[model samples]
Target: MDVLEAIVLVNDMVVDSSSRRNDAWPELDDLSAISSSFYRDTDIAEGYGDSALEMELYRLSIEKTRNLVSSGDLQRQLGFLPSMREIEVLPVIYRDRADFVEKILDSIRSSPKNAGISTELHRQLNGFTQSLNVLPDALQNFALFAFRGFYYQELAHLTSASYMPHSWRSGIIRSQLNRSVSRFADVAIGAGEKVRSKLQAAINDEFGAQVISANFPLIASFVIGQASRRSDLLRTAVEIRDSAKATAFRAWVYEMERRIRNEQDLDKVKQAQDELTTLVRELEVDLGLQRKPTQEMTLTLALPLPLTPSIERTLHVSSPAWVRRVLRRRTHLVFLRELAQESISLPPFVRSYQMLKL
Candidate 1:
């Protein structure tokens, strides 16, 4: 398909999946309602356990995919129209790795001394994220399931990491690393646990059923229940990893929290932070993982649109290919591309000088 057609199809699929009522309650209990392909692929109808089990697994996969694509509640805010608002929502785009570091420093500088500045900063960040909530359903889903939970999750983590005192840098990095490990473990151990929980909640919400419905159809439910049992095995593995992490976190936090609570001397606090850092690195090795976080800094944009109810979008573009979506103004895109080409052709120092001028 052409690019536009492909894009349209994707958006249609997302909208349909998201808008469908009672989709969470698929009529899968009746085998006759399902397509022949399901039976053809499965051996369950043939009286073999293998095909039925495969069908159940496939259903779980399809269900999980639907949930992830429809999961985000990210919506755009009203009152963003440039004509109505005095100040237009300027782009707060992070372009490179350096930009991420700069944001970290900016967040550190904005940290409150007496809770006042911190409170204001928190409010502003909240407003910013609220504006982002109104992004397209598909975009929001991609951001959450594909991106770092729609940027807010990463933003919150970054804010916390930077808000600490400079002496606590090591401790902050360690905590960040721990979170990364937890995320990796979450995916590795329980592939769709998070999305599944969201889907299950949606199902329960629709049916007004308890968190789990005990009244599943006998044979069909048993087949589906087997998938849950398999997921339980993975959950057990995740729990083991989480347990080890919690033990290490507890040990480190004991001394760290004690120092903070007692208002201990800077040197002592630094010592505790150092110990935490070392412990985190050792734990990473023990867990057969990287000492440093593997996440890359993303290129993000906050662009405003002039509509009756103005909206702000959070765009996460990994490369120039995705930049087209962010550049609503074709003129801006043309200017940017020209500038990029020129910069690439220039020497490093000349390019830097031109960038500073821009």
Candidate 2:
């Protein structure tokens, strides 16, 4: 028999053996049994010929096994396989550029702080790198930027709390970040002379290199813009700074308001309010719309207002009681808004107060 026929015969033998066992499914142990039987059968061995055919058979067998497992038939038969919910394995295959980009972003967003890339994401990146030459220029640049961005963000999280007391775990995390940054830089530098020059110009010293590596996404965007002559792709330092500031302001305001709304303790609510007010003032000053005052003070008031509900009531009410509850909440919100507006003098604060209106 030829190689194809021999492989078919082997599969038939395996299936026949499984049927003999009261129609039971084949187990991993069946592989060994089938292998021994194949070697013991002189006719089949002579029919296939040579060590080359043996190797071919081995390779095809492995390929066939993978196909079976991937197709879910073998998976269904094997009770040992983990359930989808218990152990999710994201497929590394990408259908198109959009799918690839979405997967990268989703992985980065869902990854835990300081945990670095997941195995599936790493596999996807490796595949992208291996096929980089065949990929479209736009996709190539995006993939590289995403790879660098993920590591940089991880490094930022690792080093953001450097002021805290160092421990063995922290040291390990820092070491990993350093290695990741260095490896990424080396890869980028090896891409081409132009990339190397850009990276080197930004990196004057070891410390500067670390800083640049940690912010490589911004630099990469600029470099890609220059290379492709696309002004829209360029991200200046000022733009990055403003974007970061806006994001931070929004996040801080949301967190503070969430604390104010959820907090049952009066002291904590007052503290959250004070913190929010200070944040608004700081943001205003940062935007160059206001000057810093020489003296900063926070005023606390003891009011007879009842505690706000932890859960916000919807505006669309069908009952009179719900209407009264909504009106009462609106009154408290208006009082808070007027109080904050009297102290803060910026249109930004007006937006922030509106968020408090819930």
Candidate 3:
């Protein structure tokens, strides 16, 4: 088959998985089987090569080959599934390490213009990924299932490290390690038994039918729910890591929130500020990947709260202290000028019950 045909088939795979309406979930189960079958005899990857349970792998190879090629045609037949691009490519690199490095350097040298732009590119394979996401449905479907196979391989390498055959495989596996490095409160919450139990109990207590919606499936929603708790946990982490004044943390959070809210494309840059500002002098470190954060960092996944809807139904809303602080910050206080508005409690929902002074 021509490269074009191969690309089209990959699109078929991607569309089958990621798109919500696609009736192709079964195909995904098959792709994992395909990956297994492809390596049934390949003993290079240790535990990565057991083919007994790989029914889908056999189906995938047969289906892809039969659909793409005539029964007898063979042009070295060296196509690797896009999802296995990194895995396949890395093995080639390991086999020809010097040649791989030389080619990579040569590519870099040829793309001088890309050097600066690439420096700011946070994700590896970002361009390739963006292009793939916009492909035909068949290719998309293929990719979705294929890449998941790579993840499975990575997971295997981790929990059972003695079987790991190569250091290159360690790259993707490090994400599991990155989980520890991740400062996201949500990650911690999802991984913690106590947090999950609490979150589950809270949802059962409040929604009666689990506040999780279809858009955010149950486990996924729970993961993201912890993200809602970030600001709260961020406060605690910053305090622990930096041992700073509470007001300092508040100021930092305000600045972070503002930067995210106001940032826009360069076209939106109304004025170019001078780079040699007093602020730049104060921040001696550059905002690059090589620069480590000054504060101690740890992944402290936010614990889920048994939040009732009356508390405003959003992240960080459960904390009364936050409400008071937010009011004090006056991110908005337009109504304060009115007599009735001024008379209202800070959050508008603060209890009106009065207490006698001792």
In terms of lDDT, the best-performing candidate is 2
RMSD of each: 31.0, 28.1, 26.0
Query: Which tens-of-lDDT digit does each residue in 30-128 have in candidate 1?
Result: 221332211111111123223323233323323332343344311111121112221122112222223322332243242234245334434444443
Per-candidate TM vs. native? 0.18, 0.18, 0.18
lDDT of 3 by residue, 214-308 (tens): 11112222222223243232222222222222233334333433443467433322221111121122122222212222333343444366552
Is 1 or 3 the stronger prediction by TM-score? Answer: 1
Superior by lDDT: candidate 1 or candidate 2: 2
> Which pairs of residues collide in candidate 2?
none
Model 1 residue 212 lDDT score? 49
Model 2: lDDT to the true structure: 0.32
Index of the highest-TM-score prediction: 1
Off by over 4 Å in 1: 1-135, 140-248, 276-358
lDDT of each: 0.29, 0.32, 0.28
